[model samples]
Target: MKIGHYTYQPGARGGIASYVRRLGNAQADIGHDVEYLCRNGEGSDLPSVREVNGDVDLFETAQQRRLDVLHLHRRIRHLPEHRVPTVRTMHGNQGSCPSGSRFLKRSGRPCNRDYSVSGCLWGHLIDHCGSRRPGNVVNNFRRIETEHELAAKIPTATVSRFVKERMIRSGCMPDHLKVIHSPAPDLNRPPAPLQHKDPPRMLFAGRIEPKKGVEWLLRSLPKTDVPVFLDVAGTGDIAYMQKVKALVEDLGLTGRITFHGWVEEADVYRLIEQARAVVVPSLWHEPAGLVTLEAAAVGRPVIASQVGGISEYARDPFALQVSPGDVDELAECIDRLALDPERAASMGQQARAIARDRFSMDDFVSNIMDLYRSTVTTANGLMRR
Candidate 1:
């Protein structure tokens, strides 16, 4: 099959980019003719690529390629419905709650909920009070309409059941929606040996945004006495980073926390292997916490919030689930893991078992391939009839 994958940013080190890269490569390995389409094609990894500018029409290019299927990784507007089947993967909540994180609103926290049609109008009116650019308003309006249109037109796939449920509640067609979790690379390299290091370390990876609960993690650090060292990875809003630094200092946790901003994928895997336990204190509903799966795969237990799809994995014996935004509870959980080395080790072992049994890369790829084949076959039968 001639598969065409579409992405907004090919070189981006975001989760969506990582997923498409792995999926495209895997499909090519399985003898499928695969091509990836992206804007600018900025990444060094994607060599044989088609570069697209703002003026270029995607539908024209897709038709020219005679693509059997066009798998879009981003929420695009006005996709031409050619004879070929097209699938859109919902990586995040771009459509449902406008804010993307429904939990943020439910918790009465400040979030980006003012992106819907009504909110866009209000935002423009409030521009007199603040700074709302014309482009931002136009973009929001377009995005909201595009989301509704796309939801009705194309078959959609989500990475987690949490996202699927949200879409359904938001009026997406249940029959057209599918849940296909993203797969990790095999990482053929042998697992790093567990090294005995003093000052038990906890790792928090992914973008340093408020939704990720990085600030909560920082606040919780001072309360723990297990001599914890936190390694914070990934890059995000510069202002948020500054706030985190200030909080760490205010809490007198300067020496305990290390901000290793934006580590590469290989380094991230290594850090997860070395850490005593990985922490994901997300204040929002994480569609699927990919980091948790990666941590489990490396034989490290995870301490994640009990929200969204995170509860599915974090409830396992290897995981320590805490309520979201509960700094006190999060700190206590960290301390518990840090003080009891034997229990941590046992949890790590169990985590590895869970990863091997449920989250294997081989199984993930196989399931996706099966779905694609089945969808294509069914579509063909309908055409014949």
Candidate 2:
């Protein structure tokens, strides 16, 4: 099978890019021709590549690729009825919610606002949603409409049930929605020893943004009865980073928090292994918090927000589920786990066991390939009839 993928980049360090890299490699290893179609070709891992120049049209380009299956990792163009059968994966929340987190931009609260012209437009203008700028909001509205139309017909899937539910509410047909967990990096690396940091260090290893609920995490840190060292291992915009730095200074948390701006994936796994627990305090309905799975894959317990798919993985044995943006509960979870090193170790073991049992990169790719084959078969059948 000659399978091609469409995403922002081929092999960047982001979650979606990592998936594309890993899956494309695996598919190629199994004797299938895999190509990553992006604005610029960045990696040599994938066997084939097709770059989209600025003036090139995607539909005409896709037709030229002559791919047996083209999987739309993210919404690039609205070529829904292109010559090829395009399968979509709702990797993010943009199509459904304008803010893309399904949360209020100003309040950092979860939002269930159904997509409506008055509701979303006014929500962006008056309500606490992000992008108050008319230009950005108008562009988002058009994107949302394009995605809705695409979802109404395309064979679309999501990374988690939480995301599938939200997409359905936002107009994705329930029948079109399929829940599939994205491939976790097969760290093949051994799990961390039971013994961990004596004072219990916590780690948050993703983008530092408003939707990440980083401020809530910082505020909750002061409330924790026990001292917990937090190592944040990602970078964001300068203004946001400065704002968070100011918050850290104002809260007198200078001694407690450390920022490691943009480390490699190996370092991320190392940090997760060393930490007592990982925190994923997302304010949005995260399409799927890959960080939670990454933490679990390394045998580290996760303390994640109960909103979105993080809630789905943060169960008793593997993690502690806390309400989104709830300072008190998040503080309690941090303190409770920090104080009990033995229990944290036990949870880490449980999390490792869960990862071993559930997250199989090979299985993930095989299932997707199966979907691709089936989509092509169905399309061929319809054409023959």
Q: lDDT: which candidate is best?
A: 2
Q: Give the Å shift of residue 375 in candidate 1.
A: 3.3
* Model 1: ten consecutive residues of lowest lDDT: 105-114
Off by over 4 Å in 2: 43-45, 54-56, 80-82
Model 1 regions more than 4 Å off: 53-56, 103-142, 382-385
1-385 in candidate 2: lDDT tens per residue? 7777887667567788887887888888889888778776775456566777532355566778788888887676446354676687888887678667577876778777887778988778876686888788888888887777777777787888877777778776787677778755677778868555576789998999998989999999989998889999999999999999999999999988999999898899888887989999988878778888788788888899988777766666888888888899999999888988888888988887777677678778777877787788888888898
lDDT score, candidate 2, position 279: 96
Q: Which lDDT values do the candidates have, in the order given?
A: 0.75, 0.80
**Global Cα lDDT for candidate 2:** 0.80
| Residue 12 displacement in candidate 2 (angstroms) | 2.4
Error of 2 at 139 (Å): 2.3
